[model samples]
Target: MNSATTTTTKSRALRRFALHATSTCATQAEAYGKCILATYTDVRKDACKEEFAKFGACLRESVRLPRK
Candidate 1:
């Protein structure tokens, strides 16, 4: 495949992976979303750090490749 085609294919694969990971971690995603929304008006840098950390951990676990 050409460079452009290769790039497009990789992008699509990444998008699909992200969608799958997020869906798998839906509960963590919802918690993060709720935390953000609740503190939208006066959000600080670490306002939702705990929620975000949990979401990040979930996403990492969801997308982890199985061992051979």
Candidate 2:
């Protein structure tokens, strides 16, 4: 393949990665927010913490991001 073609392909790949990462991060944020609300209003703190840990880890692994 030509250099120009390869570069275009790479650019597309990066854009797709950015889109997926952004979406995944947003989902993780929402889940954490809900978990926090649940902890405050109804759920046990330790149970909520465990749920957060498990869910957050799954998301991070999927997107190759560190737990923030």
Candidate 3:
């Protein structure tokens, strides 16, 4: 491919990597949140559920961002 095409492909790849990294970081945060929630017996299950929901929402929102 030509230089212009290569550059565009590279840019897209970089953007994908950045988004993947952000999602991964968010996943790590959710894991840590679950650990904190696990410490409390009363709300442990609900806390874990909420953490998963929050992570899902983050991913969904990220997908919608570039559309607007």
Candidate 4:
């Protein structure tokens, strides 16, 4: 395949992975978003550390691509 075809295939794969991850991690993402929104006015460092950590972990697990 040419460079353009390869690039398009990779892009589509990334989009698919992103969509899957978003759906799989929706709960964790919502929690993190709520934490940020709740503290939006008075943001503090590490205020949402727990929520963010959970969200990150979910995304990491959800988006793992299998090796050929």
Candidate 5:
């Protein structure tokens, strides 16, 4: 496929991972923070920045999950 398609797929995966990590966090806040970074930082910087912001806004406004 093309670069746009590839980026979209990777960004979706990153958002999924971030949500999973955050949702499954235990008592420790640091662990959750680390998980967010490990799962999303580079992906957001590379190809998911716009999508990430949209995802985050939706996440905050409601319980809606990211679209595939």
Candidate 6:
């Protein structure tokens, strides 16, 4: 497989982990602030910036607190 394929797979895995993680958080706030987001942004590889954005989008879509 090519580098693009590898990066895409890894990004998908990151999103999957976020989904599973949110399902188990003590609170939506906890899920929203899951450490992986920060860690990924802080240490991201330049080549995978697009994939990181995809991961961020997945978190935004999957890990929100319910409206009051």
lDDT of each candidate versus the true structure:
0.85, 0.67, 0.64, 0.86, 0.54, 0.58
Q: Give model 1 RMSD, 1 decimal.
A: 2.6
Q: After superposing candidate 3, which stretches have Cα over 4 Å from the reference?
A: 1-28, 31-33, 36-47
Q: Residue 19's C-alpha lDDT in candidate 4?
A: 82
For model 3, what is the error of residue 27's alpha carbon versus the real structure, in angstroms, after optimal superposition? 7.1
For candidate 2, the per-residue lDDT at 62 reads: 69
- lDDT by residue (1-68, candidate 1, tens digit) is 56998999889879867885678788888998999999899998989999989988887776677789
Give me the displacement of residue 13 in model 4, in angstroms: 4.3
Q: Write the per-residue lDDT of candidate 4 for residues 1-68, one digit (tens) a residue.
A: 56998999989989977886678888988898899999999999999999989988977776787669
Candidate 3, residue 13: the lDDT equals 70
lDDT of predicted model 5: 0.54
Candidate 6 lDDT by residue in tens digits, 1-68: 56998999889878766665556433543543454466655764454455445555655665565579
The lowest-lDDT stretch of 10 consecutive residues in candidate 3 is 59-68
- lDDT string for model 2 (16-35, tens) is 66665567556655676787
Residue 43 displacement (Å), model 2: 29
Winner by lDDT: 4
Between the candidate structures 1 and 2, which one is better when assessed by lDDT?
Answer: 1
RMSD of candidate 5 to true structure, Å: 13.4
Q: Cα RMSD (Å) between model 3 and the true structure?
A: 7.4
Clashing pairs in 2: none
Give the candidate order by descending lDDT: 4, 1, 2, 3, 6, 5
Across 1-68, the per-residue lDDT of candidate 5 in tens digits comes to 66998999889977766664455332233443455677764554335454455445544544345489
A best-first ranking of the candidates according to their TM-score comes to 1, 4, 2, 3, 5, 6
Question: In model 4, what is the error at residue 5, expressed in angstroms?
Answer: 3.9
Best by TM-score: 1
4 against 6, candidate with superior lDDT: 4
